[model samples]
Target: MHAAVGLALISLLILLLLPFAHHAVLFGAEGLGIGTLRDTYLIAVDAPFGNLAISGHMLAGAVVTLLAPLQLIPWLRMRHPGWHRWSGRVITLLGLVTGAAGLVHILSRGTIGGWVMDLGFGLYGLLLMLACVQTLRTARAGRMRDHRAWALRTFWLAIGSWLYRVHYGLWYLATDGLASNPDFSGTFDLMQNFAFYLPYLLIVELWLRLQRRGV
Candidate 1:
């Protein structure tokens, strides 16, 4: 619950910053901070494809920011299974489409951190899609508990858009973060990235374990 609240609070902060798009994290020449929040990238996301990609990205953020959090409430979940499933479908679809668009934006940046950034968000997209499928599989298998578990996993990945911003902010405040280089702050080293998925997966593991223990 603490983590979930963290996710929500962080998401809210991101939401506060979202209206400004990519400008929010401006730092060193290295892209000192995180996030591909640029309106320029989002505007033309997939140029030949019209604005579909950009529109989807914005819309996806809206759904996650505005609606997905409410579903986290226990009573809300129980009271609105139908709404939950419908919203879950929206999240799954939005995560894929926007994530893909985000990947394109990330790749076009052509910086070292740009590459890492692209991969991070691209992997996130694939993981989100996989989580959605796993969620459906668990549901089909009639494993309600597993469904619940995977739901949390999928939700976290979806909420990752929010987590990334908050993580970067705390990292900034803690490290006397770069003021001139995005690349410096959002740097790329394989070992450092161990902190990324390990903590993420560990959170999932701990959450599932606690659910099992009925904690």
Candidate 2:
């Protein structure tokens, strides 16, 4: 059942990532699909560094998203230890770059929900960097178990944007599209910024504790 749930979650994430990857990464680069992207890369025309930062964020995010699920698979890890190590190194690098680029974008452009959202994402980016560094540190120290725990933490935070969309989509549907309602949008935006990554970190910590106990 646990394996089934994990596979299901991964499948859903892949589904969610596909269109964005296609439109934003592939088509948007060629100046083809800006209309489909909500934020639109054309806005990047005015801020060159901001454009570079977001492009790096999206590119690194794609790499991290693709590699993270593979890292979580026990069979792959056991069967190909070398692949795990090398891929993990790449994932760590990409995750750090992704987080840093995101921070750059937020600092340069400022996020919605004012300073509250900025604070939330700022902490999220900081934690992502710390978790990724700890992942590398633990692995280098020959602490495989601790490394895995930190890697899982890093992966969870790396995909926080996807989780935010998932949560927001469900909530929007449940509230009968309250995201479209001007008055309620601010509350939802704030919730997505803070509740998304922070609660996920707590859940990942709880899972790590349970795993350590062989639960």
Candidate 3:
């Protein structure tokens, strides 16, 4: 019970913190503007299209934030009949819209953040699209369990947005002084996406294996 409660509190904290993290541009390249939200990130009405795109991303982030966590809900637990099927349907549809928008927007990001960012987002987007197809194909054949299983795969990919912030935050906290570690900073920045999700995927695979073993 204590563990569950702790996890729930952490999740709540994450939900509360999510919006600020999503507006990462507000915080600048290194995520600097911590307590400075709306005003600090405010755009003059002069840049309407740029404003629209950023707003779209924040909206997309909101959708992803709300939907990604649903996979962990108790009702959609492995044993909950029909729950997985229904949730998987919702996830796949949203995943398509969100993932496609993400890919297109990356081209506009052409920053010093480099190809790794593009690569990471692109790979994640493709994996999600493929995972959705995998789930849909299975669902069409009435293989409901297969649909649930693969939907979890796609769901993890969708959560990469949050996962990126998780990694970026930890990196900043660890490095402390970016100037002293130029080579290290660049290297870490390039590898951030890979580091963020590699272990996550490994753990997910382990969990799925345990689930298969009926634990």
Candidate 4:
């Protein structure tokens, strides 16, 4: 039953992530000048540092989002420990890069929604970096229990960008753009700045606590 559920989740995750990853790849390419920068909102000619930072963040985030689900496969980890370790290393590094680059972009260019968005996104980046660092540190110390918890946190954070889009897509479908503006300063948009990741992280925390209690 657990295996079946895991497979279902992994499948669903991959399905949701496909288009998001594709979009990230294209956006990253355009930001780096491999293609035309049609969206000056993200990639501007005048802000080279911000462009580079956000571009790198998108590219690294794409890989992290796609690779993260595979890392959760118990059989693969059991049978191919080397692959697990190497992939975990890659995920950790890319996660750090993703988080740092995002922070850099926020500091350099700032988000369209102003200080509220900046504060929320800045906190998200910091938490992502923290999760990545703790995952690596706990693993290095041979603390599998703590390592697993942190890894789960890292996984959720790694896919946060895609989740952000998914939330908006679902919201728009349900509400017909209710309380949502182009500048993203509306009530719903303001809530969404932190909603995509924080609630998921809260759920992870609850799950971790339940596991510790053997409930």
Q: What TM-score fits each model?
A: 0.66, 0.82, 0.66, 0.96
Off by over 4 Å in 4: none
Model 2 worst lDDT window (10 residues): 27-36
TM-score of 3: 0.66
The reply for model 1, stretches above 4 Å from the true place, is: 1-51, 104-112, 178-180, 184-198, 210-215
Better of 3 and 4 by lDDT: 4
RMSD of each: 7.0, 3.4, 6.0, 1.2
lDDT agreement with native, every candidate = 0.57, 0.74, 0.61, 0.90
lDDT of 1 by residue, 1-215 (tens): 57577657756755664543433223111122134434443344335343444344545555554454555666556778888778767766765666665555455443245455556556766676777677767877889888878777776766565656666567668876644254534453332333444468678989789867999
lDDT of 3 by residue, 53-169 (tens): 444554555555555566556534557747656766766775675566566556654323557667876777777778777877897898867866776776566666677777767
Q: Which one wins on lDDT?
A: 4
Separately for all candidates shown, the number of backbone clashes (residues 3 or more apart, or on different chains) is 15, 0, 0, 0
Candidate 3 lDDT at 164 equals: 71
Best by TM-score: 4
Error of 4 at 24 (Å): 0.6
Report the lDDT tens digits of candidate 2 across residue range 64-182. 76777777777678889899889988888978897898898788887655687788888888888888889989999999888888987887887776676778789877996664444
